[model samples]
Target: MTGTPRRFLVTATPPTTNGDLHVGHLSGPYLGADVFSRAQRMLGHTALYASGGDDHQTYVVTTAQRLGVDPVELAARCNREITGTLELADIDIDAFTRPDDVYRDEVREFFAGLYSAGRLVRRTWTFPYCAETDRYLLEAFATGYCPECLVGTCGAICENCGHPNDAGSLLFAESAGAQEGSTTEPRDVEILVLPLEEYREQFTEFYRRRRATMRPHVLRFVDEMLSRPLPDFPVSYPAHWGIPVGIEGFDGQVINVWAEMLPGLRHMAEAARVRRSPRTPAGVWAADSGFELVQFLGYDNTFYFSFAHLGLALAHGGLVEPTAIVTNEFYHLNGSKFSTSRRHLIWARDLVGKYGPDNVRFHLGLSNPEHQPADFTEAGFLETVRTRLHEPLQALATALAPHTGQPVTVRPETEALLDRYRDRMRRAYTLETFSVRQATETTANLLALLAARAAGDPGLAVAGLRVLGAQAAPLVPGLAAVIESRYAAATPGTVPELADLLPVTV
Candidate 1:
């Protein structure tokens, strides 16, 4: 709310060290965070963009074994692939810190602090056993065929059926050899646990209070996830590829994936602490510190991220709390879940090469996956580019070509339109509740108006257009520059190519 842009810690999972980012990953979580981060910077907020490769667990090791490569070597290769993918998609994070990043020390300290506070419990838990690897599988690598949707990788619960199951209930076939329902050996593993029941009353109170202030759609979700009793989290895993458990007694076990994710906030907080200066923005570290911490995640990860924050609060008496969390449902492509194994993903690299980043960004931004699954079609892509980014932006630039050097005066209509856009963007953070439908609709309407206005008064619209470019440039630097350059070229006889502007759209 301060005129000074509040310091924000924007975070997302670092791509797995094995492959490039797929359309589902981009559309659901990364796309929204990218949009929000870029927009925030345009609004003058000091935001530290942080992300890293999820290099731990059995999946990485199994993939390595399948490829006949060392696990560490495989992870490195995957990390590079993901980083390159993100860069290609125009996701310019400030620090793409990997698991090996210096932040691990902070993570260990954070864990140690929690343990010192009597918040961590050591417990022997039953985990999915993979006889092939002769090791216990973290939920990250565990999958079961959904009895309802009949999809594999349903893990401990069948989301399609909304039915929960214990590890013993699901069948585990070999990775490359086995028949369905064939019984495999099971392994017992020790893992640390974080009890969230301690804060049930606190979460209930917090939700009740937050409900009064948040939009109805958001409260409905909070209620659904909170309706059940909180579960205990296994903080450590038996896998050799992840962060080692900090507990003194839990040797040979890596921290669980859920535990791996909890450190992102603290990592972000430490990043902010390092960047803090005399003019440092507030709310970067402290829970009640007033800074907003927004997380963009998929529906599958809801229970983990949702309670992770509350559990963190319960662990630490007075730490900073997550200000807002945006979780989206799955993204379907041509009526099926986008899958890499089946070559079903609309690769970000391929799409960017074809239509450009700006178009991809615009399309995903418009067809947001915040509320429910959103479809991405070839026709829809072309329509968005033709109507939204290419025509209107070019037309606006063309109209303003004659007035570049003059002390430009914005027409009333242009001023009013830009003013409305500014006002809408002013509320972007407020709409952080993961209702992508609402946010996308609101953003699309503004963008449509922006496109129309640009085409309406090319000459007199220079100042207004440049102002818009400046506001958005912070987020999409390349696109903003493209807009500014094209507008400048509009002087008298010069006009930038429409194709050149397309790159910014991705």
Candidate 2:
């Protein structure tokens, strides 16, 4: 909150390992979280960033059904694919633990701790049960018209209408799998709920404190919910692929994927911090009081990040809730949803092959849907890549070659330009409405200006090159590396370590 945050943390709504990750998946959480983390570290702050696969989402079970494999096999396969895509794009995260991996027991322990703290209020409510399957229906499988809105959605919530559905009110049931017990009659069952009514006082305080930092859309949502009687959120039911609820007498039930997911961000941060801290030994789940959290997510999950997760934190005690929630609007592909199952979107592997990672990153950063859903067209992508990354960066890179071999005196004007560049980038620290779009534009405009000044004066070009290299450390690391290497004989310092480019949907 003051002069240089000593420690900071960034977490995103980890991608579900159901299928291929699209550009939409990239820009919303992973890319932006990477940028924020990189920026903080570059500023000399101890920033630890983490995200992982949501391996237990019902989507994974559906995908497993589609692939004719078990959920474990599907999760392992997609987890690898997702991590590979991030590495290929050079999206750096300190920890990317999975619920199916080392973090599994830790996540369960986290829930147990919260439960012990009495943060969880369990009230058995009537839920849909498929007698033939002998398990409670949930998520996509408990599909029917939303009781409140009459829109089609899962028993939990409607993505189309944003209404939280009551499982007991669920109508027609559809099986998550094509197997015999998939289609079934709904029977009444019992499940656990996290009542927001209990968290109202704490949530109001959180809402008030976060008002300055939350995005317009995010703030509005939280405020509306806090202004009313907070609704009770169901947290557990039967699921074939997930953490067991662990509450006695609820033997067969599993924790709702969303409920169990609340602890993941903290689990990741603790895992990363312990490794970085010599005194803190492994297996100890200690809270990092020094590092406050910041979360990045799409607007689609506004309710969960704003309320469900925050409420869980207040109840869990000693847990650090998010200081800011950066919510980006949807990014569509060619005026349509980018659905992986439909195969109507650009794949990360394919995009990198076609545009080169840096070009793809820069173009997508500019096209980020920060406030509203923006359509991404092939022609638009190409033009953005050309006009943004190619033309200007090429001209600047060429000019720096001859002069950057030595530490030439920086021209006064170019030094001023360098200061302006740093200031403009620091402005992105306003997390609620970060603008990769603006950052990219700033790079292009500043580089063009610096080039013009340096072209006429050799000394100015050297300073310009240094500034360019440092600036590149956050937006496009590859270019900065080239600047550092090409001018190694002349320039005295290494290139600033920055990440590659970023993108999302159409």
Candidate 3:
């Protein structure tokens, strides 16, 4: 927590508004971004955390169809659910935007600016069409094996390999809603595309300059992408669920939802900035805005945030290039991926309601899938809470309750513990080497250390308790606030009430 104060605009990839968020969703970018932002504030830095519901994804349309409801209505309903879930989980987002008329106009204007600059070009590509359903099979509407990993997946992107599969390019692609044995036919259509191959050299150099700070897995993925020919990214699609392309020829088409992500992020950041400084001018996206951009996303979205989005920023004359890209692998439930279609997952609100938000946050931080896939087993969760958190917290509270207002000099052992804890926090919460799991471990170690020494040296325990209140502020704000408030009111010959510090039942 000892660094030069800086300004950061931290963003989590907007959650798609097709349904309420599951634990897998909370454990990924959302919780990570929250922790990172809180840590930054603890360091006395300016960090604005911004995200919103993605209302334009094609999944919204498909889910709405399955529920026999209008797509717009379904998106609105899910957006409310997502907001409530975030609140329940104690995620402090500066701006959780939902697209309004002004937002729609801004997106169209941004796309048109890129188009007018000749950064986007028209291309003819083959698309899969289902005659029976009268629908185009693209992005959540089609299914097949991935070209790279050969794993069964949906169109547009492969979760297994973190690679993009163009519409109809998947091996043996078929319409998702087709009846048994029914197949899709190929249809050629003209749409606008971004020629990523044109920016290969620039992207290679951009990533090379950032090699030291970027994740190793992400670097490998980027090297693989640059070694092969970069595909021309589609910018427009013939669909009805997103913002209109607003071009003359593409009448019935809308801008691809992925293509709109960069603009959406920009709009959200601008909204946050305006809210923070009402007199600041709007629509300024220069690189010298004095705010560093850092984005958090899942590994499945590597191609978009690192490559496609970077390309777009470069093409627009380098407007707000990300200073850091923090990506996490998928969080699994019981050794299986959480699937909304299969209904095999735990809801965020449900988990937070059962176990308090502080415990849920700590548990998720301990099992965060940063380097590799991690599973959430109920038994493991219970054991971790009981041993790592509940027992240690209870013991510390009991030992400290008797001598709450006693004058205590800082012991040598307590000083050493505080120094090591601060060092660990400094390393774990940084943008270059961020790890929620490490942060959680640091907290657990400090708690265990303090609890083990509580009865022997009451004065040392008191000093360590002060350090714990500050160290746990970012990870468990609610509990930290209670501890800090009670100790802040400490006086000579006063015994504070600390019985409510026990862990909530799971």
Candidate 4:
């Protein structure tokens, strides 16, 4: 926080390989992360952006069963889809490794390291189980009235009120494949738990010190949890398809997916090292190397990424503590929470094909839902592209085409505008704050302003639009690279045409 870090790690929420992504997913974390990391690199920082597919989730298994395919096949396909979608959207990602290969061993080692270090608690807990299935219920199969919200709920967390309920507390069990009113009884189970209560004091200190700068909703959630007794977090499930923790007695128990993610970051780093020139020094990405660490995530996941993941990292003894936790509120689609399970969402691949990455990214970047749930309606999307983006792209082209090789002086007002753009760019980037919405909007508004003034003063237009290319290089790198290429041909003071440089159709 005091000085520019020697190394920076920018990570988005690791996506599960259960489904394709929607704009809501991108807008929340990935888009901002991509923009920030790109900007950080542009600023001459040694930044590595890496993420991996979350392949061994209970949700993946559930989805696999519904689709009548092997979980492994499902995970593989979904991982490809996710990586492809990100690539097609021109989202910069260095390493997106699957967990099925060399990564699995490292994940188990991380589990062993934490368990041996006394960070994990092995204990027995009871949960509802149907005798007919000969297995304990875990997620949707374990449906019951949520004690926290008094509403029908499934899984560990209550959507209505973000509380991860104890397995023994859910009421009116509805086991998977069981008929209505079927008698489901309690079954005692042993599992590994991350004792958050024990880590509460340290975590509380960390949270309180950084509370003022954290996202409003996330800070409130961590505040509420720490104010009360921090609950014991579970880290083991009976899922047969995940990494076996190899604990002394818990033979078949697998490490929880959430637990795997914390270490998965390290594995991703290791994999990423191979791809970098001269390679990253061993252990640099694994532990606390005195460099700043940042994690971007959505609203529902703040507790885990902030508290649980941080606890795991610290407990392992030397992983860099998260200096900044950038949390986004949500992106609502048609006033409803965009959900993949319900299939009420726009597919990322389809959106990319239709509008092109820059066009679609413009909508998300401009309307990025940071502190509040930003709505993504079809009508609003078209209007924004028409009024905000398309015109600026067109105007820059027309204004710069004539002055392509001409040098001119910029007015004081236009210079002031450029300064404002740089200030906004600073705030919207990695080191200060990961506010992509603000960055996109500021740049777009400035471009529009320049477009209007272009007719009267072509010098200002040329200078302003040229600067716009520089400022926008982080957010839309693919498109910005094209813009920068055209600007490169300009004779020092000349401008880059938006049309000739940019291949953005419509």
- The TM-score that candidate 4 achieves is 0.93
lDDT comparison, 3 vs 4, better candidate: 3
Q: Write the per-residue lDDT of candidate 4 for residues 1-506, one digit (tens) a residue.
A: 22454577778888878898888888877887788878887766766677888888777877787889988999899999999999998888777888865787888888887788878887787877677755577754577777867887776666555666655777665776566777767767788888888887788788878764577787778877777787777788765768887777787678877778888887786565556523566665555454467778887777677777887876776787777888887788899988888888998888888878888888899888887778998789888877887777687668666776676778788788788888778777756566788888888888788878786788788777667878888777766777667768766776544564446555
Q: Each model's TM-score, in the order given?
A: 0.82, 0.87, 0.96, 0.93
TM-score: model 3 vs. ground truth: 0.96
Candidate 1, residues 54-84, lDDT tens digits: the string is 7764556656765788888877777787777
Tens digits of per-residue lDDT for model 2 on 165-278?
666665565544436545555454466667788878888887778787788888777766666687787777756678887777677777777877777766777666665554
Point to the candidate with the largest TM-score.
3
What candidate 1 gets wrong by more than 4 Å, as runs, is 1-5, 101-106, 127-130, 145-182, 185-190, 212-222, 246-249, 268-290, 397-410, 429-464, 474-476, 485-506
lDDT (10s digit) by residue, model 3, range 423-464: 888788888888899999889888898789878777666666
What is the Cα-based lDDT of residue 468 in candidate 3? Answer: 74
Ranking by lDDT: 3, 4, 2, 1
Global lDDT for candidate 2?
Answer: 0.70
What lDDT is obtained when candidate 1 is compared to the true structure? Answer: 0.62
